[model samples]
Target: MEFQELINSPGLWLASSVMVIAVVIQAFVFLRAALAEARKVGMSRERYIGGLRSAVITAIGPSFSPVIVLLSLIAVIGAPTAWMRLNDIGAARTELAMVSLSSALVHGEVGTASFGVEAFTYALWGMALNNMGWILVSLFCVHRMSKIVERLYAKYNPAWIRLLMSGTIIGLFAYLLSGQITSPMLHGQYGKLCAGFVSAVTMLIITRLLAKYQRMQELALGLAMLAGMLTAQATFG
Candidate 1:
């Protein structure tokens, strides 16, 4: 569709608005959390901002996490087209149907699909805002963890363990998305179970690996556990 035509489309506008609203809500929650953490830590504004940078990296986990399912659905939708000379066989997967459905339910795909440019634009920016919000929260978590380590430096001989745990948690989350073990979005309790299992397993495996690498990383692992619990809730709860 032409840009003008796309602009005129009601669907597009609706989609964009939904996207904007989702991200804005995420940002508000994140900022509130950040403010609370800042007060708890008694951190200067500069340090808070600096911590935000690190948090951004951590926040990345959730921002793109949902995309794993979204892209899978897109691939699924595009698969038939390719068979009709639209999709490449290299990309086809059974996971698409499940992930798409899950995402549809969570994101209100019906409402979004009805929208066009507006939804798309909002989704784009909402993703950005959401990630930023996530980063802020992650920063607070990381900073708090860092302080814990500093205070108990003598007992925490394996500081590297924390970073490893965090990295592993992030990596495992990536793996579940990559493996597409089961379609989480399909209709039924089984679909939710499958999604929850995959998320839980990923969290456990990553935490275990990090723990083995460093004893001091136990604190971070605890955080990972919290993340895992939250992830499970978000995906299937």
Candidate 2:
């Protein structure tokens, strides 16, 4: 297939667009709600106010690089009902190569050779798939943690506060899992399993710490900002 044909593929564009849109919308809605509600909850007024601006820039920075190619791959992957025999292998190789090339470019790793593009491609796609798998699993950790917080808010907290807090944490977790830290974990088979385990523990710890806050919105935003900052440092540092 011609390169242009590859570029013009709608499935690729759709998948990429969805991922980008989801992450963007998720970040904005979460931060905004967190900011507005922070004052109600008694979060350090300064940090709560400043965090939204800081997060918008740094949190979404990483997605700009990979979302394009990632979307294209999603288009080509198509529906599982369209899966084939050797054609599947060929398609998979193409995706793997794209992901590998993208990853190498993003990290300045040595480029994959054209001669073994097929195998390298397979490895790369496998890695991407693995990373996504871990993310989904890690998100479960976030969800369960949010539910606990939800119960706490419903029982002892205000409705607006619960909405703001739950919304922000859920949103941040979704974005963070999609960000760069997930890249390495997504590639390795065992990496996601370890990540999921760690995330579960971490979420529990965060939940406990967050429990101290009577004002859920401010705390949620503050924590989201903190997570976003740490992730940026980890990814680009």
The candidate maximizing lDDT is: 2
- Candidate 1 lDDT over 1-237, as tens digits, reads 753355445665564455456656888899999788897988887666655654665565544444454454433322222122111111223233323344444453423454344433443343344446656887789889888767656465566666766788989987865555345444353544554455466657666765564332333433553555566667667
Model 1 lDDT on a 0 to 1 scale: 0.50
What C-alpha lDDT values do all the predictions have? 0.50, 0.51
RMSD of each: 15.4, 13.5
Task: For candidate 2, write residues 134-180 as lDDT tens digits.
Answer: 57876778889879777877777587776777899999987876563
TM-score of each: 0.28, 0.35
Candidate 1: residue 83 lDDT (0-100): 26
Query: For candidate 1, what is the TM-score?
Result: 0.28
